[model samples]
Target chain A: MATATGTARTPAPAAPERPDRPGPRAWLSAVWPSALVLLAVLVLWELAAVAFGVSQFVLATPSAIAAETWASRELLLAAAWVTTQEIVYGFAISIAVGVLLAVLIARFHWLDRALYPLVVLFQVVPKVALAPIFILWFGYGLTPKLLLVVVIAFFPITLNMLVGLKSIDSDLLLLMRSVGATRNQILLRVQVPTSLPYLFAGLRIAITLAVIGAVVAEFAGASDGLGYLIQFASTQLDTPLMFSALILVSLLGLALYYGMSLVEIALARRFPHIRADVR
Target chain B: MQSRQISAEGVRMRFGSGSAAQTVLDDLDLTIRPGGFVTLLGPSGCGKSTLLKILGGILEPTSGRVLIGGRPVRDAVGDRQIGLVPQRPALLPWKTALENAGLLRQIATGARGRTETAQAAERALALVGLADARGKLPHQLSGGMAQRVSIARALAMDPAILLMDEPFGALDAITRDEMNEKLAEIWAATGKTIVFVTHSISEAIFLSDTVHVMGADPGRVVETLDIELARPRTREVFADPLFASYSGRLRSLLEPKAAV
Candidate 1:
């Protein structure tokens, strides 16, 4: 009994691992096509810019942007560091608060009635439009950026979590209750596990938005960040610099998005029923 | 070992009140003998599931009460004395067959000693002939195998009374028959009382010592017939005149209008 409790789901006598799970070879096969597409897009954009004799101010060539990016690597990297902090902090806060609110709302009908509309209202309002208000309240700092991110990113988390909690089959819940499971037992064993796929779903959406939110927050007013770099470069009319900063922003979003997918994939290994196609 | 006799008295289940009130069950009373195999046979919308839920302590009757071995239904459930197998397999898709079967025992905070409960999972799986399939996940299992794992889960609960609501209803005829045999084997091996809910006449006759034929609107037991058939009923029994007679009687009981 103690051993069973210790390792919740390990087969007793070393059962074979799931054989059909994709390996590195499978992943490479899956990923290489997209990688090739990206390379082709870059090559085409570079050729188009050179052949058209496009002014650098109108559209910097891929090489010019890459050169500018390398030249100002130190400054851009520093701005990336600041932007990374804002997005990470904002994303984290959104998840924690969204999950907490979802639990409360799911458990209590009164709370669902009272607080859910507020949640929806927060979600429906244009968060970028509210950036100015947040700046006015918290000033041009990390605080305003995070508030906007949280305001923008937490809705999907809360809504998805709530749906997950309530979407169980009636028969399943009845079976759980019949087994003498307490409320907490049902929550921990059934509700929590049921909500995980939704958690990942919400997380995927929230992380991407968090990046946008961080940039928007900085756009409102900030001393330093990729967003600030864009504004500064725009004022100097340095298209190469502006293009490089935008590329960094895209890279940040891609990195965060990819990191989340990796985590989701790891989780899906343990809970194989979590469909990768939930998106 | 003392066996639990499940009994219900004056159990009335009504939803809503005033002119809008709708009754699902009314003035229903039942007594299931210890170590007996009983069947609740009824059509759809006949409150069979509701009655089963009431017996399992998953629902409270609008009036009256139920007892298992003289203990209240709620108390029995608290001790994990009532095991339920809903129509759906309800397996945690993430868990392998063994882990899913073992789940009830793991979550059951019953007074049974540690060593006793530890082997319950393995014992139950072996009984259901799933000892080999324990490593397989829910998605990998066939409909019948998944159903067997759920049976194993209920058995692992070590309950006094097992409440199964149309467990094989969703399967094809061949798979359903196979499951019926598997269930019959389990019931014979373990003398635990079982109250199985179903709408199938042959099924009621094949596995049950007594069949409680139920009626639809405001569901109530219209008739209770004891099957004096010999022990270890098999496919051969399906050809017997006695089996045909029992089936005819149950069919009439289920659909009086059609019979008329």
Candidate 2:
């Protein structure tokens, strides 16, 4: 047991060395193909709109949309900021509530049985249907929009958290228990750390859905936001402006989604065992 | 740490309820002296692992009881007198080798500080010849390396008794041999009572001072043989004439039970 060869034994195949992180060249190589595809699609759209003599009101060319976006830069930027704020606030609240409820439900069987069905039902019901109700209750302020975002975004987070908490290895649990570890110790030291990957998975899904929720709530009724701006542009028969607003909404969603990814990456680095896989 | 005596008094374990219930371990009785190395050798479904669990106080017997250090097994467990190594290493993947080794310190005292806990773990790792690999994660460890870490984790507690459920059952033949030799050395040095469970006949004969051959289908000990081999029993012992007799007797005892 005290021999040097015993300590010098080779690592098992099951426990392979950690993979190297992708370098700058690898990053550029991955990005450029997708970038070329997007460029090609834009060129095709511009040619199709011009060749077919499509009216700008019916289908604006990519160039027309870009020009309109540049002309209304201040208005678009301000609206994007409002929608971005709603997305961030609503997303943060959703995460907090979702994790809390998940813990409560997962920790107690009776609570889970009582609330799980109702949660599933709520998740199934089109959250857009609740947008008008939120508007009725909270009026045209940010509260209604934020509530709508929470309702839509909270389910995935809750379900994923439950999955994560419950998915611990039975053997690991037994190992901890054999050492006389208390219930709380087992939970905090074992279960919570094990569930981090699943939690991140849910966060990615919830974040993207939050952007959609904010847009739907704005469509129902809002004084300012990309969704409201899109509705206004549509009413004025300004197709290019509507497209620009739609573009801004997507851009906001992309930013928030990648923001979650960045957090996930940093966390995975800190605890490499739960390296959250890219969604 | 000095060794502790362990005994199971007519222990029985049953699964299910009423008439539909099946007995896994029935009227099983065992006793081990302090500083003894004993192996419960049996085939699969023999409930050897279940018996080990009962002795460790992780599972209560359906009837009867286990006693360690002249106290109820449950009490002994409460005092953290036993260290158990299951079939798998079961190390927390998020923790490094040293951290995994020191896990018992946290459980033993609820001590959240890392400094003292780390020193204890480091010492245990060195005993298991894994001091150099302390910083590696479980994923970076080989099967034998991971098992060594698990053993170190148990040793860090300096428990009175070590209960292993086929700790090397997953390793290749060569690694298993190496582990057996290392375990023998640890046993000689520490003199801790060890109750190991394994199905391999040669394994039982090689390391154990006494082998309790257990029969399956409601597991119970069928025979016990005192290994009269000389001290520092090495690989060359396999060539000894007495070793063949012990192996033959153990095999004969197992075959008749297996046929039933």
Candidate 3:
């Protein structure tokens, strides 16, 4: 709440003096070692490939992969874009549905008791085995890919949200009740804010799985996407192109993962008390 | 605002039924006058906290009834006549001390805008000598200060009765002593009925107009002693011979129970 003082109302603590920036010492201590190790690995691979005179089709060198990546940049970019769209859409839908389901499950004990087991059962069944069923249901379009991602991503989000809702301190609830807080008030001010950290924990895990889910669906059957490119390249013995596609897929996954982290960081900053781990 | 008289008659609280039944409070009876400061001083498991909850309408007694201002406690609670403070401050971590203090006003009317709550909270914080720490979060507060913020929260509600369950129990010796003085002052200033619970004899004698000593094993009130100490009680009062006598009497009452 904004007080008589003019400072803006924020759910979090006062911001730290300097955020999102590391000092030179921190950069040196954390970043340089990893960079040097990556350089060494690339150099070793290039040297070994040259010494063995290995065919690029059998095992593409780092240089060969880089060259192929540059030569087929447009194709790789388009595939990355398609895959990224699938993961983003699937993950977004999962958040909405998962949170809604969690709220309903937490509010009604009978619903939770009756449906929670079935939900867990669904989560446990190998999602990969359901790819064919999803394809049959939604056809070989973006719909199946989205459904697959939602299936994989939704569980953690729902489970974590349920835990968070139920984890409120009983004394706090009692206090709210004593003050005649309506049910909605208790949920908005107490349950939701208290559950933010847990929600973020689930999101961090769900987003990575979403990427994998999209790829798995594409691998099963797809007309476009990095997964399809991988399949097409290997069949034609285009080892360098296959390696490039694989690299692009991993890079896309990393980008999505980091993007989620940035969102989490922004949330953590707004509500510092929600996360003790925030620096 | 006028304070309300609270009466608990034959209040019995049972946890379970049949073979698993456990009667925590058996036929407890008490009366607290309007604007009076009363402390339920007892050991752990004595159901003092339970009794406080019953008075605050957070828990229903298995039998008997509680009334505040000649109305049922449940009805009174809905009217926002009772305010409760638990052992832990339990302030929302996302909110600052001032925001936590203002929470009662926000909930009382289901008001979305917090301007009025903020003004009321500011006054309450000032009453508790926490005006300087309003913007700090619960984690930024010391044990004593956090507890004070809970008190401010309760005070902001402007309830006729304040129900506190061991609000200062977690504080250290020095802070507890300081808090006792502050609470006594606030009680005098506000003239609101306060039902405070604690296990400390000196604390009870130091703050309350009357102390109700309770015993466990089917919790019930054993004795009620009136403290005739003058207003604005000070260190000199603690050193008074009457203070020692009261302390000695309470200790003797608790000693045999402690052995069991």
Candidate 4:
């Protein structure tokens, strides 16, 4: 969209004088707003906790949560490792199965006709509610948590990828036909490459869902995990540890999100011309 | 495929079945000779683009035939004899300008060696004054530059005929004029048969050797005017008295008249 206006707006001669790459300070500039907001929120919470004389069990202060996280960092880290495994393994399975299902659904009209409504029904079945049943059937091992993760995370991938495959400009299709391109050529050249952005979009949503699913499964029935830690700490009236576990869970999700982004960026750079935004 | 004479003989195109059917094109008959530059000029709903599509073998006519070089449209298309540029550039964002330009030669048939095909695409880019911008991506170039790449993509195939559907319609007026000048130059340089579709009278007059004015409401050709303009038409031709006369005649043919 900026193509027409870009050349007209900026004179070409000035490009040589401009910096080719962004400065190191650019990263700091980008993150400062969010960091400032987070700092302000933490300070406000600590002040309110002290001024109101709230019980530690009710609401742990920011300092207490931080200190507790550092003090028992080993145990918390171990539990975080288990939950991280569940989330990562579950997400990988979701990507494989979801992308396959989407391709199948998009390729065959009869398959789409038969499976779309069923897929929608599965998505709306409330995946978290099924955790107890899965745990009951599969035992309190990693199987139930992984199953829960797949159940919750797979839907968005299939939905976004299928839309991407099906969504092509009609004019582009005509252009392909005019050139007498084969079906295989159109799929490989146009559909699949164009679908990268949508696929990445689905992955972004699915990764978060995978985390939630694993934690919720641990909540329903689990011998280990960050969710189990949270339950144990709450019962022991140790809110600081509960808050620490929660922080770890959030950090795990953040790490997965940025990790996927990095992978996408690397892939985009290696390809014919896929952009870093995955478009 | 090499003869380059494309003709639509008694072609009829209908959109739907039974009473709900709409005839988008009806018994349309026209021929474009080898190395001729023709424009299908009309307002919206005149089925100019549809005719171009039928000629390109992208859409099959409901009743009647479109022949290229005295053979079926399909045969010509299979031989890679038809090159089309749509209204939108439709350049894949993932590819560089050069890659996008050479896409058809790479995909339509692998008969040509990679080196030869790449050189052909590069030559077409040079014809369109885009040799320097070949490394740029679609988003890096201006709208006119992107459309020029599309033209290069079409020309890369060494097709006998070129079909363009308002290739410059999306561009700004200044860019469009620049493109027209470049296109006139390309036509003169290549001497490939071109069937252009557009609603702009000035464009039809400036670039076309023959303008086929079309009428809507059961779309059909109404008038065919031969342009007497010389080769390599420059911007100064816009000031010529003959140019104004041609535009005046085309405008009268195009605009709907109100009943007294």
Q: Per-residue lDDT of A129-242 in model 3, one digit per residue for the tens?
A: 788899889888999999999999999999998899888989889888777777777777789888888888899899889988998899888999998899999899999999
What C-alpha lDDT, on a 0 to 100 scale, does residue B191 get in candidate 1? Answer: 83
Higher-ranked by TM-score: 2 or 4:
2
CAPRI quality of model 1: acceptable
lDDT of 4 at A171: 80
Model 4 chain B: ten consecutive residues of lowest lDDT: B132-141
TM per model?
Answer: 0.90, 0.93, 0.93, 0.92
- The reply for model 3, stretches above 4 Å from the true place, is A1-25, A52-55, A277-279, B1-3, B112-115, B257-260
Q: Write the residue-wise lDDT of candidate 3 on B155-232 in tens digits.
A: 887788899999988889999999999998999898889999999999999999999999888899999999988889
Model 1 regions lying over 4 Å from their true place: A1-52, A276-279, B1-3, B110-115, B256-260
Best by DockQ: 3
- Cα shift from native, residue A115, model 3 (Å): 2.1
| Candidate No. with top lDDT | 4
Pairs that collide in candidate 2 are A11-B142, A12-B142
**TM-score, B chain alone, candidates in order:** 0.94, 0.95, 0.96, 0.96
How far is A204's C-alpha from truth in model 2 (Å)? 1.3
Whole-model lDDT for model 1 versus the true structure? 0.85
Clashing residue pairs in candidate 1 are: none
Expressed as tens digits, the lDDT of each residue in A147-257 for candidate 1 is 999998988899998998887667767777666567777776788778888888888899999999999989899999999999999999899999999999999999999
| Candidate 4, A1-279: lDDT as tens digits | 122213222234322333323567987898899999999999999999999999889999999999999998999989999999999999999999999898888777898999999999898799999999999999999999999999999999999988888777678888886766777777777887777778888999999999999999999999889999999998999999999999999999999999997787566643423344223
Pick out the ten consecutive residues of candidate 1 chain A with the lowest summed lDDT.
A1-10
The 0-to-1 C-alpha lDDT of every candidate, in the order given, reads 0.85, 0.86, 0.86, 0.87
Worst 10 residues of 3 chain A by lDDT: A1-10
- Candidate that beats the other on lDDT, 3 or 4, i.e. the better one: 4
